[model samples]
Target: MTGAKSDHVAAYIGLGSNLDGPRAHVTRALHELAALPLTYLAEHSSLYASAPVGPQDQPDFINAVACVFTRLSPLALLDQLQALEQRHRRVRQRHWGPRTLDLDLLLYANLEWQTPRLTLPHPAMRERAFVLIPLAEFAPQVTIAGKTSATLAKHHDGADLHRLLP
Candidate 1:
């Protein structure tokens, strides 16, 4: 399913930034993602300012989720995400460390698979309040692992997350 089209699968991307111009980086990341081939930006959640999830010493992160229509397979989409990270100079030097940008494939339509490089429904999405809150905004009816968006939101760790802008 490398280059095949699957009726323009609906995909969700989790975006975040904590290093250098966090808000601007997130905003630019959205535009860059919208510019990718075979991918259409469908909707976006309100940007939120959230406390750092891991290694809490870093700066707070600006987070949001985006819905997109893409003909690219999951792996291909992952490739694009990594490329975007590189463009933002994101370094995985430390786990959950501060970065210029972070783009995660939170969900990929009705598809699910786990590979060394990628995982569907994003392995820890449910545990991350930063992802859950924004995702619920744009995909309140979507379900994953038999869990509704509302349920996921309820299960979040009650982190500090608030919309910075609409």
Candidate 2:
């Protein structure tokens, strides 16, 4: 989603995959994100292996976070993420079900706004170690409501998060 905006803001995106070669799906999604028009993949956290948050019968997921600089607004960025998911053959057959690729807009320039389509700072991010651990790796200092990711991660120590890649 290319636009006329010249200013770029920092945004954090959460990526996860549990189907069709999980690792390969995540890696390919990262490349696609970096190739987005007017967007730059500034940083990425190490991949982690985690149990599915829902539907325990599904395969485990490989997860990571990407910090990107982009000129696209929140909605446009969300559109691009959904488009990327569609390209990867994502299906909405079940809630939190296994997927080929899942892209979530975790945070957008620290902006706190929400619409029917998306939410800022990801409502469940703090409680999910799969998101916090990797996020704390590169963005330990990022805060939501004055709480740092490092602190949030510490709070979720009981979560089933295992580092799978450097």
- Compute each candidate's TM-score over C-alphas: 0.92, 0.93
Tens-digit lDDT track for model 2 on 45-132? 9889999998999999999999888998999999999999999999988999999999999999879987898989788887888998
What C-alpha lDDT values do all the predictions have? 0.88, 0.89
lDDT of 1 at 139: 78
- Worst lDDT 10-window in candidate 2: 1-10
Candidate 1 residue-wise lDDT, 1-166, digit = tens: 2332557888999999999999999999999888988998888888999999879889999999998889899999999999999999998879889999999998898788999999998999988888888888877887889988778898776559988955
